[model samples]
Target: MTPTTGRRPLIGVSTYLEAGTRWGVWELPAALLPAGYPRLVQRAGGIAAMLPPDDPAHAAATVARLDGVVIAGGPDVDPSRYGAERDPRTGPPAEARDAWELALIEAALASGTPLLGICRGMQLLNVALGGTLVQHIDGHARTPGTFGHHTVKPVPGTRYEEAVPEETSVPTYHHQAVDRLGRGLLASAYATDGTVEAVELEDPGAGWVLGVQWHPEMGEDTRVMEALLLSARPAPLSPSGV
Candidate 1:
């Protein structure tokens, strides 16, 4: 479907705010998003926009204009957000990004905007919902810098299953995993070692929300992104309601 009732949705993908980035001759603080993130959105028929960390208070306003939102993968979320001590193995906190993205998640949920979270995005989703993290895990990202691969089996009848029904290998790269699921969220998929690889709304009527531990933008799977775009599409008016 072309989503004519709504036009192609404009999906905002969150980005990383890093210090001391250089390309040619200018080295300064930068808001960066991996090329893969925007490419995935474009490939799935949605216009991609890079959203850098801004005043947390502006998140609601930002989301109100976007058709959908994507929380991109990034550094470890500050443990303090979930009332936990920082694990030694956890990466240093990107406090600004954490605060900003959490606000975005809240805005998306409150406004019923379709949302998709990948990798670190998933971890933040858990924390945003009053859940905790394992902090450290093995095997999922065996190698340090490169992405590993893992097959995940979806829980039957879940939205994750609806999009990817069969067991499938995904580009995996993360050290922390969701431990206690957030309120109103359910583990929709698991890894071979029983890690929570994907999560979604328990009842799933509060707009579209999905978080995957894997990096979908790094691989060939368009199903996940496609589903988000689908949710952004509004049903045509029928005079009876609109």
Candidate 2:
């Protein structure tokens, strides 16, 4: 397959594998959903491919075939991924989720594939790149509640502002926030409360890699997907044999 063929780009989306029901039956059947992820990708004109936690080796190979990746939002990342103890108030940690996402992040970065990370996906990107998370924002960011809802001011003349309405509101549903930013990531947007709303990889002057702490897939944030897909250049043809 070649990039110039105008084939619809394949976008990989991570899934949340809820093996046990936390609030109800701890031994309940496993469940997985795209969580509106496919819609967002489709809105950007890319074919959606669900990247499950199983068969990660095959999944990584699948990632190589895609033009881009969308690390869809899901359960909280284990704070332990960044050398911290988990907080009780934040609910149970998702170890499997962390493993799957970290592996995918490694594959994507190594391949230099364009990426978009949302919510927990953003948090994972930070941790995977040697950054840290607040774990809980209540005492860290000085918020009224664990969750934050505010307007962010994008850095002027940056892609954040250029991607959507000059001022737009996005849903905030996480307690953890990026603390020590990862290498190659630059804070791109922030809440009036001073919490980070989004970040971009350094040298995006070379390519696009973005992470946002919001749920843009639900509704009214269509532009968010548009911005990410537009950032991906057509992929190069398969080299030589493979």
Candidate 3:
């Protein structure tokens, strides 16, 4: 059932690798999930394409065709990437995941395709573009009773301020955060913990490209998600007056 007028934007989603094996046997099995991202995008009128981490050298062509790229949340990024030690509780990163995401990032920036990053995705975006990460939140601020949960005031003259409301709360579940923003990227929002909650590549005249530390797709606020996707959609042609 193909639509006649318009097509849903093809949003490419990156995947995480997980493996499990039987206790008494030697069979290694692996499974993949849509990472709860496709559902989010679907709600915004876009199709999600689950892409596994692949060789960056060969993935540019594949990414060139997508309307947007979403770097979904996952386990902590490799500590080596930020010149820090890995927390034992944090799982090891998927090398393939790292490579493929970088490829997508490069492609998105080059083609000016809409790009969005969530949680770990935001951290990855920072590193991929010659930026650094904080490695842990405690290192940056004092820990009160509550976790990192609060609304951020957007910069007065930024694109995000215009799109998002004056204040909004989002669920937060990351220890690492952006320390030194990547080149061309601007800090858009922040969390109560003083950690960066969001960042985006600013362009007065271009498509959308933003990253958030929280997971709006899995939370109560859908406006942020809506703003991103809606901005990505091509502006409709003016109807001729009869």
Candidate 4:
């Protein structure tokens, strides 16, 4: 499905905060999101909006106005949220981001809003759904701060399969992976090494909800972003009164 003609869907992309930053006149906290994220949404025919960490209490209200939401990739989720001790390999916890994104996920799930979670976002989604994470996985990332390319196979008859090829190479950079299936969620894609690569909500009636371990925005693939836009569009109105 394609986004509605004329009007572009508004997509909310979560952001991260650099504790301190010095730029020109300002030297304070900064809300940051990768430029690739918004560019990908625009290429897929949707308007992009940045959602910085904010009061969790306002999450639902903020989500109510957006057509779709993307839990952009960033720092590791606080392992304590999932009842796990910090693994030596786990990146430092972004407590503020963890709370904010979790709130957004809760609101999106409750309202049936379309959502796409990437990397850390994917891990947070599993934790939000009463699942656990692998904490750390060696070899998934080739170097300390670079993305590695790998092939992922999508499960047949699933949305992931519909949007992506049976075997597609993706830009991956994550040490944590979904270990247990989340409630009402299914592993829709996997890597050759048997690592879960993507997950989707089991209930078809639920609005589009997908979590991929790879970074689609970092690559040339626009199908995943397009899928989110399709779900974001409003349903066609009936010709006559009910």
Look at candidate 3 and give me any clashing residue pairs: none
TM-scores, each model vs. reference: 0.94, 0.82, 0.81, 0.94
Give the TM-score ranking, best first: 1, 4, 2, 3
Report lDDT (Cα) of residue 6, candidate 4.
Answer: 46
lDDT value, residue 146 of candidate 4: 85
The digit string of per-residue lDDT tens for model 2 on 1-242 reads 12234556777788877766554546674646555788777876767887777655665686678778878877767777888887776657777777878888888888888888998888889998999988777633325434435677787755666776476676667778899999888888888788888888767564667888887876656777777666666554475522
lDDT of 1 by residue, 1-242 (tens): 23545457789999998899998999999999989999998888888999999999999999988989999998988889899998899889898999999999999999999999998999999999999999898766666779888899999989999999999999988889999999999999999899999999987788899999999999998999999999885444566744
lDDT of 3 by residue, 137-192 (tens): 55322253233456766766776776775767766666677888888888887665
Quick one: how many clashes does candidate 4 have?
A: 0
Off by over 4 Å in 1: 1-6, 234-242
The number of clashing residue pairs in model 3 is: 0
RMSD of each: 3.3, 5.2, 5.7, 3.3
Q: Pick by lDDT: which candidate is best?
A: 1
TM-score for model 1? 0.94
Model 3 scores worst on lDDT over the 10 consecutive residues at: 139-148
Order by lDDT, highest first: 1, 4, 2, 3
lDDT score of residue 190 within candidate 2: 87
Q: lDDT at 76 for candidate 4? A: 81
Off-target runs (Cα >4 Å) in candidate 2 are: 1-5, 20-28, 139-149, 234-242
Look at candidate 3 and tell me the lDDT of residue 161. Answer: 74
For candidate 3, the lDDT comes to 0.72
* Model with the higher lDDT, candidate 1 or 2: 1
